[model samples]
Target: MEEAIFSKLRYMKKVLLIGGAGFIGFNITKFLAENRNYEITVADNFFRGKMDVLLTDLVDKYKIRVVNADFTNAASFDQLDKDYDQVYMLAAVVGVKYTEEIPNELIRINAFLALNTLEWLKTAQCKKVVFTSTSECYAGTIEAFDYQVPTPESVPLCIDDITHPRFTYAVTKMLGESGFMNYSKVFGFECTIVRYHNVYGPRMGFKHVIPQVTQRFLKKEDPFKIYGYDQTRSFNYIDDAVNGTVLAMETPDVSGEIFHIGDMTDELKIEELIKYIGELMDYKGTYEYESAPSGSVSRRCPDISKAQKMLGYDPKTSWKVGVKNTIEWYVNYINTGGDVFE
Candidate 1:
């Protein structure tokens, strides 16, 4: 993989988004595809991402191509047609709470994809890889319950204790990062890891808390019905996350490095988030926070100083604005009989 300037990429073009059909992948792919800067290939097996939810027209209009392939296998990834100058690995079994219920599957899926993709990318000589990691990598929170602050990357990442249900997802992702880092050092592969906070917006899985709340609100039910409304979460707006991804991909001298991509200061109580969602949706329902699931963390946030100084990145959209955009999109989707938003 070569380390060329961002402007130079225009001349040497082609991008392959390994899981571009999924949630965050789709967003990143959409941004690049819309600009028609690179001939984009969106490959996915649809294990979690649904083709129906994707903007297929963008493929036609922008010359974006979609291929069905599983990253778990080296052969399938090697067979991919695109010669990518930039590759974004956004495929994974996302969501810590969800991963807790399927730890073995999560470990298998996350680990294998990282291994196979790096192998294929190395074979393809693909340059400038952006691997989307997660804040869950910082598993155990050391701060007192009374302390309201975002967790920095320097915090203790107790990957050794996967027995702690909250640590399952983080442990798997940590392994994935290690795989990428080792491959980069051994093979000189240009890859950057960005640990995303709670990224929420359109096309995310309904199983995710944000979309679940929106769906419940639209169904005329109390949307804030979750366990422990006091649990804190810093929600990263979709565009902000997208911006960070682009910045990381564009920035030089960041190869083989890791950066936290999120708004550290935008912490919101689960209860407050629900009420905000309702207000955005014009929903009239009681905001109720119940006891959270067994593995749910009491607090979740990110320290984005590294991102700000290095990538010149900062979140532009307020929670209110982001939620309103999400709700509007969901409402239109529902009106169009797009049950997929659920």
Candidate 2:
């Protein structure tokens, strides 16, 4: 991985998803397999991601390739071909639990993943890449400076407390934004960034708020506590997130661009979201508000106008509709005794 620019990559029909076994990654994999004719490969270690029945079924039906390896080591790139035309870089350690409990390991893994992938791109003849980012990168800007609520990609990335455990995730993501942009500039690979907001749906795993709340309701907690009652966030359904991601990948002549991909129309408070889930579960629990954990952004949402105007990205799923679909899936999975990581 030299600092020098290499020869231009030849355009072709192959697509590579670096973290294709995860929730959003799997959805993107399915989309490309059904809608396009390109050769598709999913390379993932499946730490948080799963190699479940749905993914296995998709691979069997579509004959897509899967490479299982821990990608924290840069040499893992040697196992892959270097001639892909489209690359989706979605591999990273995500979720608040990991950031809080294992901040050092989280930072090490994420920074290594981003840096290693960029190094691989130095010689890998892959063209046109989309790096999936998070709205958390700009969360400190919004909280510290009273920045716009429906935040856009242009907002400066910041970390409120460099020493705080929770901000570790955002810090690594900021490194990714800078790493990908600078690498692409030097290497001449077309790159776009999409900072995902609160994207959630079925199979989103138990680490996120939606599934955790659903689990609590299922256990029939009498007095359910909403951690961040007043904190508001816009939830983007997985289908919409997948659509926006593909648009960023396939849309032409848009290099070195960043788009905020999330629903802005249905931003709601934490309590509102939880109570809705409780209602859906027919729970009769009283609600209480506890303080959100340290370094938690008071409020966050993305302004996706740039995405809509440039990429023709229109997210159609309402929060209620998306949550209903997600809740039903969780209920059915649990009722049928399906094993899930909590």
Candidate 3:
């Protein structure tokens, strides 16, 4: 008789990481690999993620395994093991402006992947699931700062009622969260939701605000040309987000509960952030400011009280520290003339 799938792991703790090659996924997998407690299996398709980011040398050294797969493909699902103690779904077409332009494709990919995972999760006996959702699922606001930042999970989602441009990303995220929650309710999967706010750090795409600013500065051109000076976002360090995700997984009562994960203390302005990056890079360039696009939010901050209260989650990395680290990575990447996409 054939051995049961995941049976080899009965004597050892193991975790399944979907999209484990992405920025956040790579960091989480790296943490798990170093701790050496859990055998890690990472599945990714390299869509928005780069395979090189996971560092094959580290993978080999740590005995981490990778499966080239996309969640949308049924054949891909066939390759996945039927048993895992924990499952983390971090696969999605990410980014705000990028997701906005391709709303239909975004919805289809996210929805299909959620459904596919639901099927696989039904057959697999896992202790808990960590699902990453975005704060974009929250309703659009005219005054992000005047109102409580980091809107809580209890805040009503306004995606269904909006006719605005940014709603494309918002609506789909809401649907994805709903699908996951429903499956957990009916099928009894222990699920936890983390709505991440502007998660950025090493390995993140250069297109994100921080990297974008750094890149422009490195090019010896104006770094503040792209958007309005008023726009703002509370950047959450990737490590902080990863820690919160693991915490969510560990907390048993968080089954079917949603929490926003981000740094609540800092709210940096876009123009100011750019200037800071330029200073870090020591770039002498003209600051050319422009009006932000229509879809840009004036401000966005996470209310992380629930995360702190429920899961004992707190962001230890300050914005200055996170930015300094990100800037250092950008400088090295630029010095080597490494292609961000490569």
Q: Which candidate is the best by lDDT?
A: 2
What are the lDDT figures for the candidates, one per model?
A: 0.76, 0.90, 0.79
10-70 per-residue lDDT for model 2 (tens digits): 2227999998999899999999889886788999999877889999999999889999988
Model 1 lDDT per residue over 14-124, tens place: 888877888888888888876646778888888877777266766777877788877787778756754677888888877665565777877788788888887776667
Ranking by TM-score: 2, 3, 1
39-112: candidate 3 lDDT, tens digit per residue: 78989898876767356866788888888877897668888777777889998877666555777787778777
Model 2 residue 305 lDDT score: 93
Q: lDDT for model 2, on a 0 to 1 scale?
A: 0.90
> What lDDT would candidate 1 get against the real structure?
0.76
**Reference-based lDDT, residue 1, model 2:** 33
**Candidate 1 minimal-lDDT segment of 10 residues:** 139-148
Model 2 spans > 4 angstroms off: 1-12
Instruction: Extract clashing residue pairs from model 1.
Output: 226-290, 227-290, 227-291, 227-292, 228-290
